[model samples]
Target chain A: MAFINYSAREINCKLVYYGPGLCGKTTNLKCIYERTANDAKGKMISLATETERTLFFDFLPLALGEIRGFKTRFHLYTVPGQVFYDASRKLILKGVDGVVFVADSQEERFEANIESIENLRDNLTEQGFDIAQLPWVIQYNKRDLPNAMPLEELREALNPTGKIPEFEAEASNGKGVFETLKALAKLVLAELKKGGK
Target chain B: MSLTPQLVLLEEDQRQILDVAERLVRDANAKAVYLVDKNGQLVAEAGELKGIDTTSLASLVAGNIAASGGLAKLIGEEEFPTHFHQGERDNVHITLVAQRIILAVIFDDRSSLGLVRLRVKKAGNKLSELFDAIFKRAESELGDNVESPFAEISEEDIDNLFSD
Candidate 1:
């Protein structure tokens, strides 16, 4: 549900970073906040608990370089990752224009990723967004971990549908982070173009 | 009907906001800057952007924040005061100004943490007053009914919005 004011030529889209706990969502945001040029993005806000767990949600607003004379901007959010925070996560997904499913690359976190993906689908349905048609990308994170799960196995369970783009990421060192975001941003803008307004 | 504040209505105030935000941008080295009322109207924006419908987009972003805030309230959490998005290559920061409107900045690889915070702190009060005056006028026009804005929505309009 977007609130569009035609008086100004700016279009704001909401993109949420969603996935299992500790799958590098906040890390991905931190990377973007750090890497974006001083002129293309904005402030990066994080409302995390003192212990570093996301207290509620992580929000970042990106100012994409203008397109076709219109300024394209996106606000990115990340829901709390812990299971008990399901309610909080749903709230963050309310008006999301796109989603990035960050899957923990460790074998132990495989079930978490699957459960999270299911939760994402159910939640999107509740929010009136067609998940199948949504602009979504998958990030297989923690690639640098010594005992990580195989990419094929991770993809089979997380993205077996073969629709969304997927990327490998080592968020700590900033690998594959921008690629995932750029892909999703492109998809989001593309969707808006077809739909107009 | 009361005479609304004349200095801060829509485009007139927007020009002022852009000028002020540009200063904040230069002082802070912020990549992008925008102002939104509490209900999420795009007051002004200055930066390099393409492929965005700013008017609707700013309103929607603010709406996203407000909805998310309501959702947080329902779940019994404190208002999620500030939100930031960290990407691999870029970062966005939003500051709640005077607890009225939002002053947002999108900084890329060049901005330092200290600079962004300092500029936002400096520009916060000015932005707050600018938004408050504008929101007050909007409220007056939509009075006599809290949901009046949507009362005018035709069935076709609703269907079009809900359509895929």
Candidate 2:
């Protein structure tokens, strides 16, 4: 949930990145951490295994400057995307304000993408958050792959509801990364404007 | 369906929370005291926080408490009201207060966990009362004379956030 502290005049929101294993969820966060200026960002913490796979999560707190007179801070986190880590993923979604589903674009990983999306929907539903009504965005990551799936096919299969904003990205090179974050952040702010907080 | 949980702490309420946190540090001789929402948002902090990332601490503490809550439910318990972590140098004691908020005390060799827990118990009650009053005030005045702070923010203002 987004936390608005009136005493401090600050707005804090949690945004989680989720997808199947090796879907570049963690890479998306690392790219943002590198590109952000020092003054506008905080320490990036990764709880990972020996091989650097996210064991629990990767947290990066970014200050998107300010809006009006209040400081607007976004806490970005990535859930461990391996299928066996479903329990960890559910815990991370507890109070999430927004979500970015980073789908692997390789054609061979199509089924994995579908299963992960289903997993996301089921988990979100358990938390009483309907993805259709939540501030949601989808990133078809790893677009630079030789045999990446077509954008239309991916959209049809993953975002069949056609209600979410989607972005195409090559996360390692930092392409379309900010655009996805900015879009989701905007939606989150819009939701708050409705007194949804 | 809620974008964020509105933390409507008036200046006086904030002062009260800070005062209690400071007392917790003094009585327990702890390194720092942090009050966070169950959702991982840092509500306030006190004491000599030199190298601590309070934001990360708040988030991770909330996560730990949450996972513990899940375990409690699995075993047919209402909730695990408290969790204690004993590190070599610094030990942390986390307790639930007012249902949705958590109070955490980080202490070391200067004081024992018994002292910290005793101080936390007293301070936690004071905080619960303070927060309860704040919530009541928000409910009464929220939509009447006082509008939401975000009401005046324009689309341009939001768009400008990412311009740089």
Native-referenced DockQ of model 2: 0.54
**Candidate 2 lDDT tens digits, B52-135:** 888889888988887788788889998999889999998989999987789999888999988988998999899889887766
Please state the CAPRI-style docking class of candidate 2: medium
- Score each candidate by Cα lDDT: 0.72, 0.87
Weakest lDDT window of 10 consecutive positions for candidate 2 chain B: B1-10
| Model 1 C-alpha lDDT per residue in residues A70-146, reported as the tens digit of each score | 45567788889999888778767765778999999998998999999999999888766678888899999999999
Name the lDDT value of residue A195 in candidate 1. 43
Poorest lDDT segment (10 consecutive residues) of candidate 1 chain B: B1-10
Over the stretch A1-197, how does candidate 2's per-residue lDDT look in tens digits? 77777679888988999999999999999999999999988888898999999998899999987887789999999999999888889888878989999999999999999999999999999878887788989999999999999999999999887878999999999999999999999999998887632
| Angstrom error at residue A178, model 1 | 0.6
- Steric collisions counted per model: 54, 2
Candidate 2's C-alpha runs over 4 A off are B2-5, B133-143
Q: Which residue pairs does candidate 2 place in steric collision?
A: A1-A95, A2-B4
